[model samples]
Target chain A: MILAVCLNPALDVTYAVTALRPGTSVRVRSVQRRAGGKGVNVASVLHQQGVAAIVTGPAGGSAGTDLTAGLDSAGIGHRFTPIAGATRQTVAVVDADDATVLLEPGPVLTNAEWTAFTTSFADLAHEADVVTMSGSLPGGVPGDAYGRLIGLAHAAGTRVILDCDGSALIEALHDAPDVVKINEHEAASTTGIETDSAEGVFAAAEELHALGAKEIVITRGAHGVAARTGQGRFASTPAGTVDGNPTGAGDAFTAGLAAAMAAGLDWPARLRRASAWAAAAVAIPTAGAIDPGVATDHETRTIVQELPA
Target chain B: MILAVCLNPALDVTYAVTALRPGTSVRVRSVQRRAGGKGVNVASVLHQQGVAAIVTGPAGGSAGTDLTAGLDSAGIGHRFTPIAGATRQTVAVVDADDATVLLEPGPVLTNAEWTAFTTSFADLAHEADVVTMSGSLPGGVPGDAYGRLIGLAHAAGTRVILDCDGSALIEALHDAPDVVKINEHEAASTTGIETDSAEGVFAAAEELHALGAKEIVITRGAHGVAARTGQGRFASTPAGTVDGNPTGAGDAFTAGLAAAMAAGLDWPARLRRASAWAAAAVAIPTAGAIDPGVATDHETRTIVQELPA
Candidate 1:
């Protein structure tokens, strides 16, 4: 079983309006709400793919209660530690023309609360073969939060996939997580390299590798992903165009990668699996969901090429 | 004591951002949340003024739970009936230049739920000197909900102040509540008359009176209010320019009118009190709040003049 940790979970609210006008009142035609965070999304995709996964994180207040309830209704397992502050919320106002998002900074965590969560997470990490930590850290949390978690997972003889950005990603690289998954934009920001070209992408991955990442995958939307590891450098290119929603594609990719790694697949096979799942996710309307048939079709057609040493 | 009915209470969430750019993710700098609805605002103002009032309404789900908790924290009294559907939430995204609002349609009430609330409201109305019903009705409620509530208040020998618009206001007029308060825009939409001028305002009020309204108070932002009642046609112009947030000015007006009526103040005095309270509310940053010192200043200097019959 995989244990997924989301440091900052949100009650994601999406409002569909016919038209959104600034400085005026708009009636929402419909509303959709769900438990959302990168780790939660990864768990959802894994569950849908018939993999056993449990989510753990800090949840509090009404939004936290509602998030837990939503997870329960979706039949996803979660063991969240409670805190005093309310969980954050993300509101997406979608119109026919475009979508606008308003994001609230998540609740602050006390030192005692973070320590307690880490203790519980260590216990869960011990029981799982692989652990996944995703998303941004809430306010007041230690900057080395993911680094500590990675160390705990390694001590438990379990592998970990770390997916985060900015300072958190920078700080966690010293811990040498099994795999690090980041989109091209995050890769660019973290390494200060323009990852718009293959050479630039590989250079950023090499920088993260030198910083102690065992394996690094940088995903370029629609273009595919390039990775670097001790074995060699590999690139996976998707076969056909698949389009719907790109919101949770990264989570879907992480889920596939984690599942393949747990099944002891090689790096090439893992890339194919992850790319297929991501493409399938992009073919659906909502995040953290994929069409199994589409994934199967893309898996066989996905091309993996080896780069020169 | 007065009883205020808020059939559709909301968890009002306001987000402050440096700028709101559509189709992009905006980081909210700060967030403010409160229990809000028209009648709830009335009760809040009354409580601040030291006037005894109790709030009643239907509340459900997480938003409902938070709404009541907020009210409790504010030291307000309430007895809300429970329902199955979750309460609604309204989001206001404010930038330096302007504010955009997204309004959710409130929860749908079952016929049984409406009956249960009406029964509870009747008991509360019977014990109070006056009752005030404010704002729009939730979906699945009877169109004549305000009309029925007004009739019940009359049967219990309790005066009622109603603030609603469109079909609800038009249908409720036949019940002849002691007072009907509406903004100028609502007045125009309800009577199909352009109420931009004093003459048009009075003409719209006369039409409403013909439909069985005993007293009509039409508020024209910053300009003051015009009224028509059995005592005579009277208008109250605010003393000076007062401005801040006008979101809850109407509710403040309703609270002042209810307070004056409960104290047996004459029509002219009631108009002056309502106008002063509204002006005070506009001088503050949030809704359901007022500057008492500003109110006293406006009240003494307000101009009351009789209009031709």
Candidate 2:
């Protein structure tokens, strides 16, 4: 079973408007809302793949309740710790051609709330084979929050898949998570290395490894994923470009990696699987959803290439 | 006691972003949410003025829970009927220079929910001196919903002030609400007569009177309000331009009208009081909030003119 941790979940609201015009009142044609966060998307993908996964994090207020209810409606298992402040919300105003998103700063948790969530995470991690923590930490949480969770997951004998960027990624690398999943932009910005080429990606992965990650997975959208594992370095790219919404493609990649690791797949196989899942995610409109037919077709079509050590 | 009926209340969410750029993601600097709708705004203004006003309407789902919570936190009285569908939400994305509002179509009420709300409204109106029904009716509600409510309020010996637009306004006029508060745009659009001039405004008011409105009050931004009452034709304009958000100015006007009627004020006095409140509302940044200092200053400065009947 996988334990997916989403510390900064939101009630993702999508408003379909005829057109997005600045400084004007627009009547929305329809509204769609659901629980969303990177980790939540990972759990949803895992659940859709028939994998046993439970969502664990802090949820509070009306948005929190709505988030949990959304999970329930989706048949995704969640055991979120209760907090005092309301969860954050993200609004996406989608017109015919593009979407504009407004993201709110999530709730600030007290020390007590953080402690309670960590306690809950510890318990959930103990019962899981793999734990995947994703997304940004909410306000008032310790900067090395993912690092602390990595320690707890390791203590519970659970392999941790850390998917985040910036300082959190930098801070958690010291905890030596089993797998670190990041997109190319985050990898480039974090290590100050251009990841447009294979050598640059490997160089960035080497830096991350030196900092303490056991395995590094850097995803380049459309170009595919490059990874450095204990076995060797490898890259996987999709056969063709799939088009739709790329919002949760990375989360789907993390879900695939976690699933492959739980099944004890090799590094090359995990890379291929993760790339296929990401392709499937992009073929769907909403986050936390994948096209199963697309996933199956991509699984066979995605090519895994070996790189020199 | 005034019963403020908000048939289509919303959980108004405001996001303050650095700037609004279409097709781009913007991080919101702050988020502010509260119970909102025209009637909710009316009730809030009435409460701020120390008037006894209770908000009554059908509220459901998490947004509904949040809406009611907001009302409670503001110390406003409410007796909302519970329903199965969730209330709608309105998002206002404010940047440095302007605001862009996205209005969602509110929830659809079942026949049972409508019956339940009407029952509650009937009971509440029985004990109230005035009933102010404001805003657009939600889907599935009868077009003549306000007309029926007017009949109920009248039967209970309560003066009714109806504030709505389009067909809902046109249909309700048959019931002869004691006061019909409408803005210049709504009035012009409903009557197909431009309300840019005093003559045009009076002509529109005359048309509304012919359609069965006992007293027609037309509010023109900056220029102030014009009315056709049983006593005579009158117009009240604020002494100076009150530059701020005009979003809820009309609701504040409705509140002022309701409060004055509850106090047994005549046409001219009610127009003056409502104009002062509307001016005060324009001074505040948020809807459902009025500046007491602004209200006091405007009350003395607002000039009422007795138009030749």
Q: In lDDT terms, which candidate is top?
A: 1
Report per-prediction Cα RMSD to one decimal: 2.6, 2.6
Listed in order, the DockQ scores are 0.73, 0.80
lDDT of 2 by residue, B130-197 (tens): 99999888888898999999999999988899999899999999999888889899999999999999
List the pairs of residues colliding in candidate 1.
none
TM-score for chain A as predicted in candidate 2:
0.97
- Model 2 interface RMSD, in angstroms? 0.8
Candidate 1 lDDT, A1-309, residue by residue in tens = 999999999999999999888899999988888999989999999999999999999999999999999999999989999999999999999999989999998999999999999999989998897898998999988899999999999999999999998999999988999899999999999889999999999999999989889999889877888989767999888978896888899999999999988998988899999999999999888887898998999889999898999
Complex DockQ, candidate 2: 0.80
> What are the runs in model 2 whose C-alpha is more than 4 Å off?
A220-224, A235-241, A301-309, B192-203, B220-227, B232-243, B297-309
In every candidate, how many clashes are there? 0, 0
Error of 2 at A226 (Å): 3.8
